[model samples]
Target: MDFPETVRWTFAGLACLTLAALVREIRRLRRAEPGGRARVRWDAADQGAGLVLTVGGALGSLHLFGAGLVLTGVVLGGKAVRAVRARRRTTVGRPST
Candidate 1:
């Protein structure tokens, strides 16, 4: 399948944005005080999933791989989102230090 140049560029742009967001989140996580082991694990998983998704998106646009990777990325991304929401709910009533 021939993808238009614009489609490729758009994917590239999204990949760049995802990378930036991943970096920012990592920095924030590092600065935060060590929390529960599960929270840390979830954050690490989220970062890993984001990286995979970004790569999948970029490769999909270039037609270097099939939609399988993209689908996997999407699934992982959804898990990350759910984990984050669950974490937030668990912490909502806690008082800030």
Candidate 2:
């Protein structure tokens, strides 16, 4: 199916933003640790989210808009799962037992 010029430009803008966000997140993940340590560990979940966003952006750029939407769903689902887990953890710590 053919898309209009506006739709194409919109997808291109979204792709650019996604790529920028991915880069920012990766840099954040790679930040150094304290105590003169030149490195730090990273969370696999966060890394995976970054990867998903990157793939989504690439798909959008390549005109695979549907696939991009699917990947964006994946990224959102991951965030929701993480948020639920974090809430559960915090609530569990404050148990009335």
Candidate 3:
């Protein structure tokens, strides 16, 4: 497949991930039971990861359109690292029970 197809699939996948994560987070927050700091931390981590995915997808798509090719691997590699960092932050912060 060409850059266009690759970019399209990447964008679609990012959208799906965002949609699913958002739905899950909303459901978690909507529950009557109070959520502890850990839950909140994980939620925030998820949001941060979503941000990276969104930005990476947008940039990759733009480059693919304007430049006729995208460094999708590098762009997404950085984004994956960012997502890992966010998860680390969520886990590192100690939460009271």
Candidate 4:
């Protein structure tokens, strides 16, 4: 494959892997009895996975629609960060149930 095609495919593969891991983690969390720490960790992982996939998708489609993907990813990432921060602030000093 050409260099650009190779790069796009590579990014696509990585994105798929990241998305799969995220799904697996979500399923595990749903099936098991998890503590607050575990839940928080999962939440963080979820956001990270989302970011990874978004970036990968943007890079993979660099020839077309890449700009839109990048923009969407940035917006989503920002929202996730803000949400996480707000959640942490609200949960501070509270007992985990």
TM-score winner among the candidates? 2
Clashing pairs in 1: none
Q: Which residue pairs show collisions in model 2?
A: none
Q: Write the per-residue lDDT of candidate 2 for residues 1-97, one digit (tens) a residue.
A: 4556666566557657656765665565567456322211223334444445444444444444455456557666766776688789999868586
Q: Estimate candidate 2's alpha-carbon lDDT, on a 0 to 1 scale.
A: 0.54
- Our tally of clashes for model 2 stands at 0
Runs in model 1 with CA error above 4 Å?
61-97
TM-score of 3: 0.40
State the displacement of the C-alpha of residue 19, model 1, in Å, after optimal TM-score superposition: 0.8
- Candidate 4: regions farther than 4 A off: 1-3, 36-97
Provide the TM-score for each candidate, comma-separated: 0.51, 0.58, 0.40, 0.42
What tens-digit string does per-residue lDDT give for candidate 1 at 16-97? 8767776876776777776654455455556555556556555553333344356556656766887789899999999999
Model 2: residue 75 alpha-carbon error in angstroms: 2.1
The full ranking of all candidates by lDDT, starting with the best, is: 1, 4, 3, 2
Give the CA lDDT, 0 to 100, for residue 34 in model 3.
61
lDDT tens string, model 3, 1-97? 2346577667768767776776767666666366354455456455545645554565554433333223334445656776798789998888857
- List clash counts for every candidate, in order: 0, 0, 0, 0
